[model samples]
Target: MELEVYTYQFLRRRSRISSSRRRKSRSISPRRLKSRSPTPKRHKRRKSRDSMSLVSESSSASGGPKENKDDSEILKIEEENKKRRQQEAELKLIEEETAKRVEAAMRKKVDESLNAENIKLEIQKRLEEGRKKLLVEVDAQLEREKEAALIES
Candidate 1:
């Protein structure tokens, strides 16, 4: 009887120790959970700022004559920019045309110079060839005359 009573008390003490450990692991307070939620709070603040900026922009667009005037001014500036671009294009075309004329004139002068040089070289070669042919013909005629004189004498 005494041993059974001691075993029962020991089992109860073991169960109490385990239950205390479980309680310690699972004990979370609502205040601690709320403190952990501030990260999401900060994200909500950022979202609110974005939404407020959108609302303000929408409200301002829904207001009076300032928006119309601003759009017209923007359109006018675009027209002026288009005109300037057209003028620049025209200037570029004129410059290109002038450059083409200058290049053509330069090419003509170079061609004339090359033609003159080629003509001079051809005339010199022809004159040399004619002189050589004349010498050869004269030599042949002299040999023929000598042979004829010898035959006659």
Candidate 2:
């Protein structure tokens, strides 16, 4: 009876899977698909510097190229900006040099502390600490052994 019920369920599932409800597994391949983007690239127009010239009628007005008021203002602003940048660079250099000097002094202090005499003193201190810890541990172990001996007796 159980076999018949299971076979009926299996047959129904197989029929459902084989019917229009079947899902086709797509197989992936190592190939690129055609993009065919909607918007095409636009053609850009380029101008050459060789064909450019000053529009002013007189070229000797300022002994140089004729620049408009806005251009002159921009040039002045650029000069001011350049000067400011130079000052900032100089300040940064001074700060860096000061930092380097401070760092060198700090490194020298560290080197001095790590000298042979200081290193020997540091090692002696660590050895003393280790000896103290060892003595405490040994005392604790001796106390434990003494307690065990008394209990055994």
Candidate 3:
């Protein structure tokens, strides 16, 4: 009887599902799909220094090159720039090393001062304890002398 009931329930669920109720995934638009797709190669326009000049050098007021930079002058400028960069790098490295050494020395000094302070505190504690013991002994000695004097009287 239980098997019949289980089979009937399974068949009821199968019957409730219909083919017309099926759904399909959404489709992509052409423009968005094109943007996501791979692109083909195309020719590109290039701009040069001469083409970017405001005034034509060939018809200039001085009738000379718009830029006065020669090959040797450009080379000299590049060499000077390289030397400046190297000097700057060396100076920065020296500063960093000096700063590190100074920081380490400061830390060492601080640690040494802290250790000296701790030692001073320990000595002070020991001195206080010694004074307390000495006072106790002196009190006991005075009481013994008073008892002896009374007996002699």
Candidate 4:
């Protein structure tokens, strides 16, 4: 009987501990849910307001002739840099175009040379054929003359 009472007491204490843990977990989850809902909006508003004030304050403080002069000088430097970059780009394009033109001229020269060589070869072939034809005609005339002499004799 005493052992049964002890077992009952242990089971009751375990149930109580589990119930308390469940309550703690439930309470913590709701707090986290509520805090996460509105934190981002509030934080963003605060940051934007802070940044705007800082910008206004700095602009007001630095609103002077010296600042304007510095700004103009910076602008001039930027414009000069931009012009230099544009000139460099133009020079690069001109160089590329020149290279292309030179390459095309060299190709044209090579083609013309090849065409001239072909023409020379064709002329030589035609000359050789004409020479052969003339030789054949001369031989035929000599044969005719010999035949005529024999007949006359």
lDDT of 4 at 105: 100
The per-residue C-alpha lDDT of model 1 at residue 70 equals 76
Between candidates 1 and 3, which one is better according to lDDT?
1
Clashes of 3: 0
Q: 41-150, model 3: which lDDT tens digit per residue? A: 21111234446354455435444353444544677999999999999999999999999999999999988886897877987999999999999999999999999999
- Per-residue CA lDDT of candidate 2, range 1-153, in tens? 775565566556655795557443342221122133323321121122222334333433544443566568888999999999999999999999999999999999988888879797988999999999999999999999999999999
Q: lDDT rank, highest first?
A: 4, 1, 2, 3
The C-alpha local distance difference test score for the whole of candidate 4 amounts to 0.76
Top candidate when judged by TM-score against the true structure = 2
Model 3 scores worst on lDDT over the 10 consecutive residues at 38-47
Model 1 agreement with the true structure over 1-153: per-residue lDDT tens digits:
765565565446545886436322232432243333546876899889798777667656745457657777888999999999999999999999999999999999888876897877987999999999999999999999999999999
TM-score of 4: 0.38
Enumerate residue pairs that collide in model 4. Answer: none
Q: Worst ten-residue run, lDDT, model 1?
A: 22-31
Judged by TM-score relative to the true structure, which candidate is superior, 1 or 2? 2
Candidate 2's TM-score reads: 0.44
Top candidate by lDDT = 4
TM-score of candidate 1 relative to the true fold: 0.36
Q: Which pairs clash inside model 3?
A: none
